[model samples]
Target chain A: MNAPPMLEARGITRLLGEPPVQVQALKGVTLSLQPGELTLLMGPSGSGKTTLLSIFGCILAPTEGELKIAGKSTKGMTAEQLAELRRSSIGFIFQAYNLFPTLTAEENVMLALDVRRKAVTNPRQTAREALINVGLGHRLKSYPSKLSGGERQRVSIARSLIGDPSIILADEPTAALDGVNGKAVMELLSKISLDTSRSVFVVTHDSRILPFADRIVRIEDGNIVSDVRQKRA
Target chain B: MVYTLALRNFIHDRISLIVTLVGIVFSVVLMAIQIGLYYGSQQVITGMIDHSNAQLWITPIGAQSFDDSAFLKGGEKYAALSRPGVASATDVAVNIMAWKRADGGQQAVVLVGTDSDDKSLMAWNLIEGSVADMYKPNAVIADKAYLADLQVKGVGESGEVNGRKAVIVAITDHIRSFTTLPYLFTTLSRAREFMQLGPNQSGFVIVRVKPDASVAAVRADLQKNLRDVDVLTNEEFRDRSVHHWLFATGAGAALIAGAVLGLIVGVVVVAQTLYASTKDHLNEFATLRALGASAGYIHRVILVQAVLSAIIGYLIGMAEAFAVNWATRDTQLVMLITPGLALALFLITLTMCIFSAIAAIVKVTRIDPAMVFSR
Candidate 1:
């Protein structure tokens, strides 16, 4: 009871497009994500999965409903405050493996540390340690262009883990990876959640990942049709 | 850190950076050359008036420049000496006449007539020979620059001026007039006789003021005392001499037009180059913004980059100007590139770069981070 859920969404709703032709992207979705939880959000294409992920990641705000992190409601928060919250409390792993090409793999992760406003001494060393945790210790100095697709995603994961945030939100991280590398990346995320108590929220359309999640929420056309934690068998 | 980023970014666009540097080099070199020639021409025009030993000149009514010839009916020497501020006064006679050269050619000269006794003001800047020889009846002084044109054999050489035998008694430095013509200094009696007039004819009444006297007060008193006569300080005369030479034709207009054209070309080149570079890097800047860099941070990077480029380019350009100056030190075309002139050019170049950089920034700031994901 002393450790509250790291992420909570209460009746979250959002609309896209201008008035008179508004398209509802999310319809009053509610969820609580505790530390050590590995959750998967599965939906067909155009089912508002990405919209829900962006709202939870603080990159986009919901038009209605309260979103809270560590029991603090994110109401009337300024843009700077949201950025600060993202920097301090949440880590994001994009599907594109958005590593700046000009920087080395280690420096790519170190940039996350820089944006987090942390007073880390020797960011390269910290970045190397994070990479080693994700099994990319030897590829620290390689540029993003030099790394393979799997290694690039590992670097992205290292970048997200560099800030040691309470929750990690990943959007389609495995969509670009092949089966073997994708499975490897998913295993890494599960290990991070169990070993470090960092709640991991992943949005994916791949059914292969459903077995790996502690809970699975299924969405169709923008509404959650089923929320199940485990197989009945 | 932002400086480091800007430098790296600049290095990335090596070709653009080189083009920008070349533009600045051309601008700075042109500005230096233009300013040097402008000031050099001014010096040439005002050199004689600046070096003259006279404190003031008194001419006929409303004449501010020496070209406005005035006639005094008498040897106003005593009349000027009687003034309260006058230290000494002498009658001067000036005439324009042709002198025979050794080459059998005739060169026009301003024949300046001064008293042989007033050696202090008679060919005072003697580069060669002696000013004291003016005591000789038909002796004349010429400027060293006109030595080849006059084709005089040597000192004591004779030449015919106004149908009278004139000896090359001495050569003086900086005796050339604003018209780029040579002046021949002669004794007052000879000049008066050569340029025939009534017995009382005098071209100007020179006046000298005491060190303790106020120049303004002196000028006012003299203008009042000598009714219908013009009186001016030495500085005013120098200004008028320069102005007269500058405005005589359309030369000043041409020089000014050239400078203005150079400025326009420089601003356009820098602005266009930077703007193009910005457009090419729109994606890169959007990526940086998406990575949490603030607008202010991006602006700092651009501004610092422009300043660095300006400084490097200006220094290289100034070095080129100095090379030109050193190459032409002995030539008549004075390439006087002063530090003040170089500094002014640098400031102007920097301002143009800043304006151009701001233009680039305006285009850059309009790029939204969403563009990185979409386009």
Candidate 2:
């Protein structure tokens, strides 16, 4: 049998907010993430794309149904176990460029390795490599506040990629950048997705990111409307 | 990385860090001064006993301390001197007497008289003149600090003790009384004359144990011979005096209560300051959580921040405390900051900061990592 998908969500449902008026964020959503593919979950505002991404990242527990990372069932897993899964197998980038403002670019990237119990032998060297790969080698000592919008986003990407996890989750990765910077980030993401051992999952409503996607899945009203395979243009 | 995260976060908000450190420094200085006052007061209370060479003392029954002892009617000194283990014994008279200053102002003075020539229970730290000079009529040795109270300038000044003519024969320095009264040192004959008593009357008696004799045995023998007086070792008498002044009254307990209050305030202020600092970074902590940093890891980061605050605050506070000690060195309210006290204060400071970190940690743990994805 082929190896199991990097992440899987089957009949996943999620409830948010307090009872009496709690909103159903996801209603029986089913999805699977495969290695070597850049998949996009597209939807408008208030759609459950971010919620689904959170589930895939192991940051939230589904109200119902089975979720798994690397073929292992996430059902009944504790929060700590889910964190361990995310730490070891998954990386995340946010649209707002969640590079810790206090840390230099290299230190922000090293934080990923620091969170791991046992990973890279040489953290500084590995962090430099990750930043260099994301085209931030010259700005290694710069803090997030000192970097431009695009540079800060690159630092976040470097931080996400430092631990060498099997999966990358980007939440509206280019939503806050200008056109040239946005196009540059998308190109970098597309290039990173080419590594066969890694799967890239992005959640966004921006149509500008569609051409870089290897597969596109659209969601509306907390439900998937379509899933299609496409060749990257 | 934990230290890195902690230190960076600790210094990120300079205002909050200063508030936290100020709380810690205030706590340390307050506690150090209060405890130091207690030790200083104890030193003053027991200075006479500590300076004595006598192994044992014979005091009147029901005497609480040296200053409160009733005069022995007769024969306690002879009884102690007649004991087999006792080599020599001398009468020591201690009483609060009326002092008529040269300026016509009256003040209460503690008159201490010891006739032991081997320097037992005698006035120390003499700046001028000899103890032998106290034999000239009503001559006495006085401390320079008490010159204002006695209305005297230096040696050769004259004052009156209990309506009798008294002359300053020697001058000493830093010999202070816990009661803030002046101490006047004189010979036993002069003390008897000043207090209007006959030669045989005294308040306490000092006994010297022979070189080969056990002090406990000599004390037991003295107690066996003395009928109406209580025989005690010098150490036992000093402890009694200290306990009587320190615990039997509200003075020492007040100092302890103040120290405890300082500690409580320190913890609360630090806790509030740290909680505020942590709240300032709650978003980043949530981001760390969502990025797969463990709850334990985040907790460690906050605790490490508290440790840093504690160490820095403790050093600054100790420096301030030492300065306070130095400032009060020659004053009436002296502070004695020993090494042990400094170490204890450092440990207490750490506890306070760590205690403060718990409040910050609670807020951090309650944060939902999913919040990072929302905005």
lDDT minimum window of 10 residues, candidate 2 chain A = A1-10
* Residue A32 error, candidate 1, Å: 6.1
Interface quality of candidate 2 as DockQ: 0.72
**Comparing to the true complex, what docking class would candidate 1 get?**
incorrect
- C-alpha positional error of residue B180 in candidate 1 after TM-score superposition, expressed in Å: 4.2
Task: Output the lDDT of residue B6, model 2.
Answer: 89
Please give the lDDT score at residue A22 for candidate 2.
Answer: 94
Candidate 1 has an lDDT of: 0.76
Fnat computed for model 2: 0.60
Error of 1 at B234 (Å): 4.5
Candidate 1 lDDT over B201-241, as tens digits, reads 67776777888887778778887877666787778777776
Per-residue lDDT tens digits of candidate 1, residues A100-157? 6667888778777776767888877898999999999889989989998889999988
Top DockQ prediction, candidate number: 2
Please give the CA lDDT of all the candidate structures: 0.76, 0.87
> Candidate 1 regions off by >4 Å?
A1-233, B52-78, B88-208, B238-250, B327-332
- For every model shown, the clashing-pair count is 0, 0
